[model samples]
Target chain A: MKRKVFVASSIAAALAGCAKITNGLNEWQPAQPILNSAETLNQAIIGTRGTARLYRPGDVTLDYPVNSLDTPHQPEYLSLIESDFTTYRLPVGGLVDHPQTFTLRQLRALATLDQITRHDCVEGWSVVGAWRGLSLGSFLKLVRPKPEARYVVFYSYDHDQSGQQFYGSLNMAQAVHPQTMLALDLNGKPIDAAHGAPVRLRVPTQLGYKSTKWIRNIALVSNFKDIFGGQGGYWEDAGYAWYAGI
Target chain B: MDATAGSSAPLPRARSSEAGVVVRRHSLVTRTTHWVVFIAMIVLTMSGLQIFNAAPYLDASDKSDPARRVLSLDGRTTPAGSVGVTTILGHELTTTHLLGYTDDGQGGETARGFPGWITFPGYQDLAGGRRWHFFFGWVLVLAGAVYLIWGIGRGELSLLILRPSDLPKLWPMQAYYLRLRKEPPDHGKYNPLQKAGYTLVLFVLTPFVIVTGLVLAPGFDAVAQPIVWLLGGRQFARTWHFVAMLAFIGFFFGHVFLVVATGFVNNMRSMILGTYRLGKHEGTGP
Candidate 1:
């Protein structure tokens, strides 16, 4: 009886001491920043110059899987869908010389680019998609981001079950890449609710989650430390690497 | 009889003593690399399986299609309860309590491609699995490189690599193992089967697995599109990666079996202490 009690006490003490460690198995911070190093090495060796090359038009794939389609805030999505996104205004501000609010029509009127590219998901699946939109580089040129801006934070209408808004960010180099765009169309069709209607960021270089959908705001910031969860992106906060080049 | 069994054949290469003949079997490099690889491979394989559970499907085309799934783990409902179903090449098999849905580590069943016990962290966390996989992946590569460099420089690979002369001795070794022959054949440090198995793993399977692994990385694929194309795309690479993992697992079972069967103490001593004893009651036969 005494030994059993001692074992129980030890177990309790160990659990108490390792509260953070025991909460989640894969939640601990890495000793070495492998993801960051991999991203740097990938960039250096590939010589992509921050650009993930486009695919040929013939390679455009129609079948695509929609993941994390529903949002916790259904009313917000319903209102956007009800108004056909006409009332939607994408506010681009923070560390920019000229902050601008762009409507769907206004975004469409900007210099357009169409490219087919592969979307590699972190879940080990992939799809080739043809996207049409204005290059984010062209839009960033208009916004005139301040030299202090180091990252571009994208806030979207969608939220997880916990009501946390879906958000992601990109380094300045990737933000201004020619291939990165605020995509409006997919496969010659207007973006649907199932696929982040109105506008979504298309970052072919990075994993799928980085290409955030239903974008509501774009903020240029020096750091994402003050953002929600303070991990650059919602998924990044949930243990995914911020730089998912692999 | 056992003492005089090999008198007519070639004498074993060892220093004979009263009890037995002791031979220096492994070098420090070989033993160190072997253990390092063993640990790294365990971590790599478990974490890799965890990563695979994220998608749990294999395909050949660049774009994934539900219909073209070559392998998948999913759930099924029956009157008894929910069960796991594993589908391979359009053939379905009920693999309940093993895959698709299994113990959630809290005395409950949860849906997952692979079970919790076999996976690292005992939970489904792709990011965590990825971190562990990549970390050990580098360790494995570095260790393999060291072994390769040392093996080549010291001409140690000749023992592991099967030469044209080793081919003819394979059947005899097989016969000895199967007890079709009364006596084991005269051999050098490694038998013919050992040379073949080691050669296949060290040269063919490991390199193929590594190449396919690189292809699965989008960043690498972006740079080496031509090479990826030759491999038939990332999805194809993923399929082959799983196949290679299965092959490695099979090889591991066979390796352990041989180690245990052919005088477990002596084999372990050779690997760990760099010495092996050859005498009566050592292995299957004289």
Candidate 2:
């Protein structure tokens, strides 16, 4: 009986300690706020909670607009993408031996492959689509990264109202995975504007966001800690996990 | 053989209260089975979380274009003839496109079956989900069967199954727990709360998760109607599944809390080694 009392008291003390640690971590506010403040945290939390309020409990609606060559052209639905060999320039900088620029043509000149894969969303939706592009490994080889380089960060053109760019990072292992590709085509034909074209990324093992859509620049960094939001990606800085691998 | 057996009998009986603790408690087989169940639960939880992640959503906006361009099917680059070949930062390259399509007000053709491009299965992908869940379930059921049989043979079930005397004791236990007054009761083997938890998990939660999962199986539309009706139609089943999942999550966390609270070392040793060192006056308290 005395032993049981001791055990119970010890357990109570442990639980109290755990509760204090959790509460403190949650309440601690960083000196420099990057994304949403505590006030907006509630709103963001509400938006995420809305996921449970799905119209169809298990069903998901793919709201992205789809297009085909056979469909009649609607002027309003006309492509928003503007393309010219000269207009498309990829800026590669940060911790590199040579800072160079590559147009759409240069990227296409390399070997390419077409792959069919699924995009699994965290909200519990999945869709399969064919993607065609050059291997990301091939591009990484061309860069000939410095010995100090530890992470490769992708900067995108798409952004929220804050002018913050959509970004993602890859460790050396995943960056060099043979399956990772910089895709330019969908299905059997070229990618439509609705889909990321010119060049988008395809990382089969990760979620949809890990595969960034629009490509505008690339940066090699020693560490991800100094980056904006300090969490690696735009959404990650807000609250998302950096490693979204399945 | 008879002489050896006779000699060992007196030896065990002589030390029954000292060296042979199993004489007054669980048999070796029952203790082993209980430990197996404990280990299985831990493995299932860890590996299952790795398969489908829900926590810690990533923010992709701050990343560079190459890092951000992880995957895309839409053509957004400029036409080949318009842009020049230029490297941005020695290594990174960007290409614009002309073939990008805009999503006007009209929704496009609904693709049938699964899309051919993406490989990750979603939560709604009943086919894939069922495959993994059922495979794991068979293992769980087999383990549970062995446990049930051993428990019955060893009279371990008596400790687990609630008795009439447990009814009134629950209120006082609850009060004790809420007020943090004292150790609730001296449980012979399993406490009232432990019995209730194990019962619900075995007879209620597991069955619900499995049956509802089967009902949502893909390409099995033949039984869909009957199953739906049994669950009070599709909507009700879906709602039930969601609610049941929440309850299971709650139970899982509560189970962990109990393990942590009830002497982690002793609990772990009991479940792993099948040897529980009952303290002096262990079952004497109220």
DockQ score, prediction 2: 0.02
lDDT per residue for candidate 1 within B1-286, as digits (tens), equals 2221221343345522222776556667888999999988987887898899899889877667776789988877779999999999999999887888774434356777876656765666788777777767777888999999987776677656888987888898899899998765565556778888999999999999888987777667666778777877778888888999999999999999999998899889989977777653232111
Put down candidate 2 lDDT per residue, B85-124, tens digits, no spaces.
2222243233322111221111221111111111112112
lDDT value, residue B29 of candidate 1 = 84
Fraction of the real A/B interface contacts present in each candidate?
0.30, 0.01
TM-score of each: 0.84, 0.42
For each candidate in the order shown, give its overall lDDT on alpha carbons. 0.78, 0.49
lDDT of candidate 2 over A1-246, digit per residue (tens): 999999987965564453344233223455124212322332222211101111221222233323211221223222324333246677777777876788877877874766665444533234456667887777877777787877778876566555566688876655676667788876655655556655667675554666776666888888889898887776567654455442
When summed lDDT is taken over every stretch of 10 residues in candidate 1 chain B, the lowest stretch is B1-10
Error of 1 at A41 (Å): 6.8
Runs of candidate 1 with Cα error greater than 4 angstroms are A1-63, A69-77, B1-21, B181-187, B278-286
CAPRI-style grade of the A/B interface in model 2: incorrect
